[model samples]
Target: MGRNTRKRRTPPAAKAIAAAAALALGGGGLLWANFHASAHEPDQRAWGGNQTKAATAQVATVSCPDVGQRLTNVPDAARQGVARELAALDRQITEAYARLAATRDAQAKDPGFVRNAIVGPLGEKRAATIDRIRIVVQRAGGSFDNALEQLAPCATRSANQTNAGGGQQNGDGQQNGGQQNGGQQDNGGRQGGGIGGQAGNGPVAADFVDITKVAPNVQGKPRRTANASTGTFTTRCGVNANKNHNTDNVIVAPGVTNGAHHLHDYVGNQKVDAFANNQTLLQGGTSCRNGGDLSSYYWPVVRVQDGTRDFDQNADGGGKEGNVGRILTPVQAEIKYVGSPAAKVVAMPRFLRIITGDAKTTTNGLANANAHWSCTGFENKVQLTERYPICPQGSKVVRSFAFQSCWDGRNTDSANHRTHVAFADPASGVCPNGFKAIPQLTMRLVYAVPPPVIRNGQVMNAYAVDGFPEQLHKPATDHDDFISVTRNGLANQIANCLNRGQNCA
Candidate 1:
């Protein structure tokens, strides 16, 4: 399974298409901006204005050190040891931040409580853990400063304090506060009316163009196609048995606690968080039906909130959406894997993370275009609503997710964890040239949402996922994240079986 043993092929046409698409979409420029933008940008705006504009202190470039690289030159035993210690440190860092966020949320109204009771203690603990991480990196012969720079800043010195002043405001007041604080407002701060916004009242026309429809029709037949001889292997990961409500697993968006604004259901790996590295993930147990495959899968917690309840009732600040009430668990989770017949699929590098859907979307209509909501039998009839769908008596509600399967052969992750990978052409189901095709992973989630109750002239649905809480839980907020932790044996099996076209379970 060494890197040099794998054969490399160049699909010049596909590479050209991918490059053209990247340029046309301005992906390179956007990637640069996202990388340079502050991880605490949203939180800073949430608090009010930038407090560092006049400060002379240089901001550190925060990133995740590639633990994979550090293991290369080391002996096998020593490599394992490094991974184990790093995993342990990752957990410690995440727990420290979680404790801080919980305390901050609980005592949000009291600046003194946050500063003394929350920030000070947690900041010290985080700093210590970070120091330990640096030592671990140095022991592995990597630069400590480089490792530190990959991390999100643990301290926030300029968070706004007035919202915690014991005053509860309506959604409009919250929106206005965001505007006055120099935060960008979409659609005059209407509930869910900005980027990633859900539809209001009724379904609106699709606002975003589907990329597959516009991508150039690269002429030429695919070298391989899935047929009777070519097989597919599927792994049934069990239902989301764990809820990850903290922001610790999102390494790229460090220092962002509850940044998702909603909870997520987790499956496969038992121990995963913002700080988890490949070693921790490999050592963890799984909730998957197969048990052996330890890949991580997660998505937003979908709830069916009634008119009386809301998810953001306990939320701080003003841009709150609707009532999200008690969170509901999904009935089941289905994860499957398949590969192309023309090429031997390559193993995914450790900690290869992928995300779909826009977490920042508001009511701008098209933000959640990737998010699809539908009733069980009528999966084709998708809708864009802020409210949960009221399926027919016998129907089930479901959320479907498809992930990108092509890799650039080098990096497990990028600044965005996206640019390094691209989706196969929808028409040809063939990955572009230069990228290796891996197992295509797809997830189907079913939630328990009861029929809607008619109140006044409005059709009110029960429970919903927590978003801004001012807007309805629209499909725009539907998103998922995955990190491959499949053991090397199984990964090779996928490659061997798929290339030979043998079906596997």
Candidate 2:
């Protein structure tokens, strides 16, 4: 797929790297490095500093590392060493940008503070970190520049400085920040009073935003209609009634602890976690209705909060919220495979994992395009807002996700957990020309939320998904991860059923 032309505000991988680096290196080390650098330089531009003209712009080309090939071919010992060094560099880069943001935030209180205390030092430290990372990559027999490129969140060249007014002009000549618009940093930096800053930027009430009513046609396309004629098979993964407080099992970003941020409702396999291997998952007990089927289906725990309460009040020891408190289990979980009736689905590669939904919704509006939210019994009434929906008295709130179903004939995963497989065409809903058709895995989670209460003529729902307390629970935040742990028998069952156009419930 062609990369999106717009620059991402903050890359998810970068944030994860920064967070993991912070946890590994004590905050004191980061503070000392920034402080020392800032004390020496008084005038150079900050990292990603504003620039006035495109003519004067200097383009920096960072090459993307062949991460997929590197991981597949490198010796275990060498890979481990590279990973450690990369983590250290990630910490330094994160701290540099953080210090830069702090200085920028202080501009209103103290004039010239950003230039004297932050700009030069931040740029120096960031450059040093990039250089160190390059050396590490070279030592591991990989391209140093490629490592830097991989760390960058966007495809565009990094802007050296912002315009005089603090707004940076993009290739199209649009100013991204400054006084005209709020002086929000475009690169995922803190936006004053924006959703990126805190979770409670909106009203505290547990009310549905009624996205269908508010922006009825915000989503240009009609909601995807179900194709009943398509062959399908389902795995009965029982509901996880008990609260799963396990913060370690998430496979989204390996090596990062509690990467999910919010609590997860686990089903299928009981032992799937960050460190789980195929062998471990195969041997692990399952929560599925069928004992032989051991696939893992997990997603963020949804909670019903009263209008006056917040979901993160009982956060875990790491100060990460949504791990504790009275968690609500889905009424049931529907895990199924759907595919073209004419095609045969080959057995899915073992331990294949897939993720859907945009984790960084605040800055990326297009990220939520694939996210689907609707009320049961009123399936056509789809809403794209991330908050809990106001279902009718007898209806249930639903969160549904459809995973890509076309495989490249080999490779279980790509660097981004996608790309190894691609989504079928929207019009035909069939695998593209070279890729083989696989059973499209879809998950539908039903939440029995309370009916809305009228508050000032607005219908308020009773709860929301347990997301970062600082971020308002929006539909853009809706994400799901799936890891296939099925042994050959179950995988074959899906293939056989789908090819025969048999519906296996």
Clashes of 1: 40
Please give each candidate's TM-score: 0.53, 0.64
Candidate 2 C-alpha lDDT tens digits along 109-168: 554444345433433344344445455545666643333333322111122321211222
User: Residue 191 error for model 2, in Å?
Assistant: 15
Best by lDDT: 2
Name the top TM-score candidate.
2
lDDT (CA) per prediction = 0.44, 0.48
